[model samples]
Target: MMNILLLYISPGKTTEKISKALSDRFEADGHRVTRLNIGKPGSRTFKEVGSSIFYDMDLIGIGNPVFHLRVMHPLTEFLDQALPYAKPRFGAFLYLTYGGISSGRALLDLSNQLKKNNIPILGGFKVWAPHFYNRVEYPDIEARKTIDEFYSRIKESGYQPLEDEKTKRLFSYQTRKVNIAYHLANVIGNLRELPIQFDQDKCRGCNRCVNECPVGALTMQKIPVRDTSKCVYCYHCAAVCPHGAVICPTEKVADMVRTNKKLIGVENPQNAVYL
Candidate 1:
């Protein structure tokens, strides 16, 4: 059995779910799979990071949710810090979960970076999940099928880059335009000192948000107050709040969700674009 390291950053948990599915599949197939969430608190220290990827694993699966047509910042940071310590010539696969504005350039970008760092590409897949901004169905039938197919191919063929023709066709000009708009919206969203607002009345000061914050951006002095400077805008604070007190940039996030839904529609096979 091969030892596989599945490393990913999933603030919204969509990518985390996908990683789990992959891990289960790999393990059930008799392979040893170690999964790590790089975005979690205290998960990115130099020593901790080194220990995860420094060893010689038979395969390394790097994954993240695409934000603004790029890999999530925390995952990028981890890669920047940890890739140097990783063993060279190891096979690696890339996977991305996107809200459906052309997984844009993220897969290519990551694959190129991995290649530059001496990690051979072993194929990649882009799957669609619910948009972080709105309530939507996720990991639907098609998404799971795509996930199963991806692992099946990797198991059968070993390390190989996925065919790019279909992916190129899927990312059309309209998708690119939507992606550009999403990028601009993200920039605007980050300008706010508090991109997420907590409902004072609903907030019970339970400290759940504070503890759940991956970056320690939330504090429970009198209530949950977020330090936007420290926040990477992963939205974990909002996601984990039991009282639903945390409110994100609704207008901007709604626009993004609507744009993606309008352009890409709902459902996996229709929304997902594989590489």
Candidate 2:
């Protein structure tokens, strides 16, 4: 049993369930699991570097190779100060993410940083979930099988890394200016308030969302009350809500780049290039 930290970006329940299942299997196998859902926001949503160039650069390159650098700048700072359970012999760092124009560039950046810190990346698994804000496709059996395979890989000695050639090229930081332009368009369009919505009728007040939230954004009650200011919008609360109540009442970020004529080749929404 290895001490595993499975980092994932789960916009919906399928990936969260997969992460939990992986944790359960590892724990049952006598391994300790520490799961981190990076999709959720941390205490500080945005860090101020005091340069307009930072936002300009990131927005311009949003999902381009260079965009990862900009988004990673602040994240690297956070990781330096707050890498979880660092003393443990972290055997594998798995990334479960969806593809899109912006994609899991953040995960790639994080993976590189973890490697630099001497953590072995077992491999990353890309699962197709709902497109951004859409409902998950082919719910029951598909999700179960995917989760099963994800867990079974834990016992494997050497997991081959999965890469899509098109994804690598589209997301690679080949030209600095082009990357900046792509991210810039995304930033301007995505800057909107994401308000959390709860269906009181559906919520049983089990406090699962509260307990599982990385940030203490939920409080126990007949129904949970969210600390919007504290919430990172990781969508964990919504994804895990047993009653299927919590929701993000905002425009899907993908809508901004959906019209891009160049995004045709990226098959998976996860690999879509926003420019």
Candidate 3:
């Protein structure tokens, strides 16, 4: 048994699904469980990263590397504080998303930091499904199966914390400055808002999206109004939308992709520390 905190950052259904699975497994094995969604205090990404520089800022939304690195240092410091406070008997982190979605350099940094701080990480994985960034185009049946198998492997291993040296060295760099700035500019140019739209005629007012929201950004009323201030841009609300009313503002992103284009890639944001 262990005092486990399954810390996660997710877009929508991913967090709920992962948390439920982990909580059930941990509690069944007689361990203490607390689920914390690493979230932005407001819509301000810079502020969130500035406050918790050492932890992970990328878990909420995808951004360019420059914007990511700007906040990485402080985020790491914040995670340093959280590690000792957790004092976990054992801990595991699971990031749920598409298979190729690597958080960026920050993932490696976080892993190294955890090991250096003497926090045991059982393992980490990516859960593949429909991405909140983009809708379900073609489901990764194999990846979904792999995610299940990975969870099962973790269950069988019984939370054995181990060190991964390769991961440690992967993110260390002398010049994070130059690379990060370039990435941020690219992100800004490509930035297109994917606002949530609700169809009042179809809405049943069940509030599934509201209740399952990792951040309390949605409220069920005559119609749903998304609180952009509190929303973390994780697509849980859309994923759980019974009426299929919520979606990206337009298919603009999709329309741009060439017919033969392949879209699977992973980037660990500058401030993300993967465990």
Best by lDDT: 1
Cα lDDT tens digits, model 1, 232-269, are: 76676777788988887656666655665565544334
Q: Write the per-residue lDDT of candidate 2 for residues 87-180, one digit (tens) a residue.
A: 3232333333343334335545655555566544444443444543566553346545654665576346343333334324433433453365
Candidate 3 lDDT tens digits, 1-275: 55544554444344445555646655776765655444323422333434333243211111111112232332344566555544454454434343222333444456666667666655555444444445454324554454456557766766565557634543343235435533643353244335678888888888877766655678777878898876644455766787887765435533322111233223434122233
Give the least accurate 10-residue stretch of model 2, judged by summed lDDT. 56-65
For all candidates, what are the clash counts? 0, 22, 25
- Candidate 3 backbone clash number: 25
Give the TM-scores of the predictions, in the order they appear.
0.80, 0.50, 0.53
Please list all clashing residue pairs in model 1, or write none if there are none.
none
The lDDT of each candidate is 0.69, 0.47, 0.48
C-alpha lDDT (0 to 100) for residue 220 of candidate 3: 76
Q: Report the error of model 3 at residue 135, Å.
A: 8.8
Give me the runs in candidate 2 sitting further than 4 Å from their true place.
Answer: 1-11, 20-90, 131-133, 137-185, 195-214, 218-229, 234-275
